[model samples]
Target: MSVTGAGAASSTPASGAGRRVVILRHAETVDNAARVWQGHKDTELSETGRQQVAAAAPHLAAYRPALLVSSDLQRAAATADAIASLTGLEVRLDARLREVHVGEWQGMHADEVRERYPETIAALDRGEDVPRGLTGETRAEVAHRVGECVREVERELLPGETAVIVAHGVSGRIGATELVGLDQDVSDVIFRGIDNCHWIELVESSKSFSARSRWRISGWNLGPWRL
Candidate 1:
């Protein structure tokens, strides 16, 4: 999951009846540009990142997201703000939507991680859970909290309304897959990873009895082509 823009997978939205949720990853950060691990470390967006989100605004506005929620982290908040500005909605911040906390690896270069923590890198490359970093989190833990966050956000949505959840790349996959009830065993094959400022849309009929059973990927890796 720490491998940003490193893998590939195919996903198609499934049909079910609740709210359509769009999970938007924050614009590129300094770490993202440099392929460094950010984990929960708060990093600001790069200048190019700002421009990328600006380009994404109009397209995101097309969804007319009813409510905007974001990780309080500055990078995500800033991206959410851009989309909110276009949609004319207020942003609600949720810390649970934050990235996986990779303690000591927060600011290390990706190459360094591969060089020093070969096993850790190898595990992630294999799509296996590795909580080997100093106080780092497992993919399941991240998915658990992210799933809870979406459930709470969905509770506040009205029929046919979309809720945009702005978060980091790792959390985007974990949350999106979790929202669609993607099996953990097959998760690696289902989603490789998401790009910065890109989004995955999960839709469900408002009439669905359970959020877990209703959600499916309606759109994946969507964003302004320029971004």
Candidate 2:
């Protein structure tokens, strides 16, 4: 089933009033390179990551977003900081944009999880909800939270303004799928793997909004260097 909302539309930026929301995944991190589950585990960008952001700055500068927002997580926040510095826009920290907490899987390499908790790992791979960490959030939960966050951005930001959101791959994918009215299962499969520092643009109109893949290389599975 396709999800519909005030923020769903075609690829082109809409006319009339309403703010355009651009979602960007953060640059490369050491955790990303190691193929570890880094949910809610704070990790700084590697030296190469910093350079990647530097290279991407020019492309982001083209948008001239009025406000730049990011998850409070270090990886995303640091990326927002760099973009803000380049664009002269202040960074807004939104905890709601943080990555989905992977519970017991946090900070563990994929191989380790597969070896140690084979059943749980297999369940996750199959999209079956098993008991995760005591406080960890599920994919469904994260989707709801991210949906609300997108609504809040539209409600609070001024019409005709553009806002840039720096977030994690999974969360960003969820948000994108929701915005585009795609089926959850399809979106889940398509977004299961995303690259670092990739970006998607969503343009808003008076009645609705639409999205398009802007730079997949940075956000799909490749690094910023490759872009």
Candidate 3:
């Protein structure tokens, strides 16, 4: 499915009462190139992934956030380091930001899984429970973890301070959906398939936060290409 674009802000005010959180998915990886389900199983960024993160550094530099947070996963940590180098911001590794654990499916080719476990794939498409391989996490579990992470971000926000979070595709999608209060159906539809390094911007306030805004920031596609 083609992802829709939300236009960028005309001007990011130098200061505002609300907090602006920029959510970035990490750069590409070898698994991403191969279209695998790399949930939680750590993987290093590919050469292109490194370059992509480097290219994104300057764009992120404009935000000037007080803190840069990333998933503890190596790929995300690496990307966060790259941004920290340019922005000179301290990077905090949040384990809550890690990718959705796909259990036994981790590091497996999507096509292979589909062929071997067609029924499971069908069940997932229908939002029904299926065997989540060894060490894998369920969709609901991921949503809860991401929600906690969002709370952490909200707690850490200070007036006029922006925080950048670099995370994985599944968790990023779940977090973005939760931020905007999007219904589960809509959230599932939007996040069912997404590119790596996709950027999502969310505003966190003592009152409300959301992902449904008209403002669109270019997201980095940083994951296994085949999700």
Candidate 4:
């Protein structure tokens, strides 16, 4: 849950009596375009990614985010910067929001990884929570860290407020599973990976007894135009 930044949330929550958290995936990156394992690599966004950020920024800004946070990686941080530009809030950086670390697979193409670790890939395809890249953290490990970040974000939020977090695909999806008390086994299939620049919306119930008194998904894999 370690994050770095400064500033207070400035706006009121949307017409709701709960804490809303948006976990947004970073835009497309050079490695993503090449189908390479981006895992903890400091890859920059592609040109299409820039355009994506431009389109997606407005939707999130419309939420009138009280707190803005992002992964320290450039891809996510850069995406967060766009939203900050629209809202005039400093982006808090957190490493926990980063994508799964690929270990030996970092920067390697998907085909190369398939050739090197067929069974591992197969297990992953079947949604097994094995350690990634044979050396990196397990899915549960990522869920724990990112879920901790979500909890920390929750503590920073006031009732009836919104927080926008710029993060990566794998982490964001799995983390949302943890945030909502879902079984870790459902990470890959239940909430499938979101496209670049898409986002997951979660609401924490507290203010009103009318709403379900637990965290729940409000929307998922949503793009700017849809929301």
Which stretches in model 2 have alpha-carbon errors above 4 Å? Answer: 1-19, 129-135, 205-227
lDDT for model 4 comes to 0.83
By lDDT, the better pick of 1 and 2 is 1
Q: Which stretches of model 1 miss by more than 4 angstroms?
A: 1-18, 205-211
For residues 1-227, could you state the per-residue lDDT of candidate 4 as single tens digits?
21211112335665557788888899999889999998899999999899989988888887788899999999999999999999999999999998998888998999999999999999988878788899988887888899899889988988788899999988988777777788877545565677888888887766445432378877777775431
Q: Give the TM-score of candidate 2.
A: 0.79
Best by lDDT: 4
Which structure is stronger by lDDT: 2 or 4? 4
Candidate 2 residue lDDT tens string, 132-182: 543578777888888778667756766566677888988887776666566
Q: Where does model 3 exceed 4 Å of error? A: 1-16, 129-131, 191-193, 204-227
Task: Rank the models by TM-score, top first.
Answer: 4, 1, 3, 2
Candidate 3 lDDT, tens digit per residue, 1-227?
22434313333445656667777788888888888888777888988888777666666666776778899999899888987997788899989999887877887898888887787788878976454653577777877888788767866877667777888887887777766556656667655544555566665444434434422323423221332
* TM-score of candidate 4 relative to the true fold: 0.89
RMSD of each: 5.6, 6.4, 4.7, 6.0
- Candidate 4: segments with Cα more than 4 A from true spot: 1-16, 206-213, 225-227
Model 4 lDDT, residue 216, Cα: 80
